[model samples]
Target: MERKQIRALGRRVKKIFIEHDEVKRIWSRFDGMRTYIKLDQFEDEDEEENDDDDKRNLFLTGLSGVGKSQIGKRYAKSVPRYTEIIDDEEIDIIPVIYVELPYPFTQAEFYKEILKALGTENFKKEPTVNELRNRVFHLLTKQRVEMIIFDEMNFIMRTKNFDNQSAMEMLKKLSNQLQLCIVCMGTPQIEKLHTMEDEYVRRFGRDRIERFEKCDEKFCELLERIEKAIESPNPIGLHDQSTGLPQLLHYYCQGRIGYLHLILKESFRLLNVYEENVQVEYSEIRLTVDIIKQAKFNLFRKNDHLITPDNVDKKEYMV
Candidate 1:
């Protein structure tokens, strides 16, 4: 790719960071979670009752490519890191700490991950699980972290040595002991963690991130926003008069924002290669769909139910 082509591709890729309705919703939820954390933190310490039993934990689940991780990162960045006055001393408070769970994780590995996220240089050098856990708790409390977000939480289920019950216990213990909010983001498979036990289900509230439905008004609005975000020298009619762009995209990408991103990135790359002044047309989009179909053969094969308009039912796609 030449300099201009590379620049054009870079511009298109940068547009992926645009905050849509989904991103806004995630932010709203994060704000609410922070409010709850504040309330719990300031509760009467002398009260005989244990109000901390009420879980302020959030479980954010969605299918792959629905922007779960992206929204989590955005929320993390929005939190202001500052110092708080406590007992005549200034203590550093990290409003949010985001960590991604490693695959085949164990309880020890999980705490090690938290220690690593806290910027501990020799975290792996901890001799025992007790030491690791103590270090994690000490760092989180000392730093005064309001919320801890665990991304790719579904890895708990895939771990060969760890069972779902043990993972749930660990999470529950952390939230109860730390007195801070915990947000877990992962694929829909993580929903099984909630279903494994009633205590788990009661403690963690669920938040779902869904893809764009074909016939929904928001889908059309999203398309318009996406069109405006794309910068082109020549005017581009993204949608065809016969079949709307939303419908076409739904059929090709199965309403996945990640797949749509791939299609658009490839489309822009194609325009950079052939057209002098980059402008996207309905024909170019159609060609891009064919190219994506060939490139993502396995994806198309798996989601064959979304391949045609006839297969898409009114109940599922309707607003």
Candidate 2:
């Protein structure tokens, strides 16, 4: 071939090689296993014929990174599509609104945060907490919100004794008065919502929402899918059996969905930046590992006081 022709052929081959490699890597990252779709269930907006004005609630409990938010997003997507058809108008759809609970030092602060979220800036000027709450409720009700996703109920769980009780009461009241489906997405601590006082537990019905548990098969399937999504040749290693991808991921992220996404995105970006022969070499994996190790070390080192027996309590392993 001529010089120009040879260069063109080489460029085409490189593109093909990169595409093939990227495909495998992406597949490993987002296979169906970890994505949390019920194979038998189809996505539909009108899955539940909930009153448009009334809020429909569902709680998604899981470890920090086991895919609850992804499921929440999927459900959020379906709501707008279904509502659009039902309303038969070009209705504005926010689709989903995610709000992490503000860290509340005082019971009063909890109410203040809720007021701020609902745009009631001068809430303290209001006559009563109930009045301020009512005003906020009316505002949200006017927005035609389909659902309110509380992304970090764990924050409330971690509150001090007095603040914890008040926060829980406010949460329960918010769900009841708004009649919105309040999906509490949080870590394992959220289970306290179930085992707590009867008054709080009564509203969140036992059958309404369940906690997420990782089965061995499902976990392995998720790992396989993540590997396929990331196009990793050996997505998992034999060492994974004793401290496999799932365990490592759980340890690194506390199985939190948001953390997992963040880590995976960073890992993928690193892979893209350091490609060799159209593949992310083992060195890239080592780099990611080192990064995680350092992070774990820093967290344990800095937050030693928080690492009580009730908490991570693995300071010795941090090294």
Candidate 3:
């Protein structure tokens, strides 16, 4: 086929299959359940434990590009839903405080960011860090901020020395003092923070108590749904009647929900040129699969090594 014809096909396929909004909605709802709701509920219950007078804290650890930050944002968005269940006296609306911990390794710096997030800027009284910390606590306590989400908490560890450790201790102390469930979201390296010392491990509790990874079945199902949402019926080429649709999609995605979308999106871009339905067989998809797998491998190879302080500055580690 001519280059112009191929481009035309790519454009047409994109138009036929692309429901960007619907795809996002589907992914969001599923992500909310599989990732956010589970964690948010933990925090919600922790808040309730304090006679509904205090917020809750939770810590979420996962692999990079494994949907931690995405789910964190969704959890924050869903904070309003908890308001309906909350009594007016207990909390007017569940205030979700989401702070990306890309900086601020010390208690002072951390508190400064907390204050900034709370919209308390420039205390003319020249308050010390302790004072600002107390102010944030009081504000959250009074405001009924039901949830606090710390995304990219791995950044805290990059500050070097024991700063990250000390900061985490302060966080744990605040969680106990305020009876708030604080959700810490970050890459798998975050487990290192807890595993470093016997005391540290004890303070953070057991691994099963905090970190949760998605099951393979759930991941594949998520990818299949995304494929259905973004795929159009093919018309011209050989449509292998012998094979299964879901099976084909699952194979293409290789169990990574994120890569599934990326491949489908790129494939559509390549097929937009012609509006005619072209049958996409397993053979046609082999090239796409190879491309996606190579990309994935290259990405993992670059960062799969131990997350050193230096490597943490790369794109994957940043918020």
Candidate 4:
């Protein structure tokens, strides 16, 4: 296939989203947060924030590329920011702020991430952390931002000896000071925060998007869904027990959905329906195990141990 055609097909493959159990759980959590925020009726006559039942925030942890970031982005997109006329000025009503915590993160960077998500960060000249923090709070309140998703929160935990404790405290502070829902996504290391005796630790719900533990019936069910989405010319019977493909794929992907997605997308690019390879009854081209076997090498550039000959041979037993 030509490079142009291959890329188009690859993009289509990349766009597929199977609402598996994990994904469904994420969506439910996100929607629950959204609904709670809408129904939040806690109030205080005096100058105080009431969080008696404001545990709508979420801390989603998982392995890298395990779909946390994707779900975060999708949820943020669902409640898109928009401009509205209030009084006499155009106001930016950003319901959700989605920003990735920059690596080598600092307290200043933390504030800037939120500012950047709000589309109000001054890039030409850097501002003091104090200034940025004030601006973040002000803008979040002014724009009616309800939820703030801090993706790649692994950096926030490390802080690299740079006011690490204070930085984390900032997350808690944001929730209390602004009564905002704080959603964070990152590696499982971020879950360490739960062990601390923070004032608001219990107010944050925790969930993890884990990889498949086995190539059992559940994994085969996912394969069946992916096959349907791939819209391949002919059904590959990936879920068929006779194929022994589920086990092989579970091994290849280390049960990681990310690697499985990468392999399937690359396979789409490799398939040649009209130009080369086998054509079924002069009608349709079919995906084969051979193509997937070749696609495994496309990742890691031959660096991953999972793709090494020894590992592959051992994992073959699962097939």
Best by TM-score: 4
Q: Per-model C-alpha lDDT, please?
A: 0.71, 0.46, 0.50, 0.74
- In angstroms, how far off is 245's CA in candidate 2? 7.0
Q: How close is every model to the real structure, measured as TM-score? A: 0.78, 0.49, 0.53, 0.82
Q: List the residue pairs that clash in candidate 1.
A: none
Evaluate model 3: give its lDDT: 0.50
lDDT of 1 by residue, 109-142 (tens): 7988887667774833545888888878898999
- Across 170-235, the per-residue lDDT of candidate 2 in tens digits comes to 666766565454556776677777567765454443222221133245444544455444443333
Return the lDDT, model 1, position 68.
Answer: 79
Residue-wise C-alpha lDDT for candidate 4, range 40-155, written one tens digit per residue: 55544474544555667777888765777778887788786789988998999989878899878887877887888888766677788888888888989899988888888777
Worst 10 residues of 2 by lDDT: 206-215
Count of clashing pairs, candidate 4: 0
3 versus 4: better lDDT goes to: 4
Q: Pick by lDDT: which candidate is best?
A: 4
> Candidate 4, which segments miss by more than 4 Å at Cα?
1-7, 42-53, 122-124, 272-286, 300-317
In model 2, how large is the Cα lDDT of residue 84? 36
Given candidate 1, what's the lDDT at residue 17?
Answer: 63
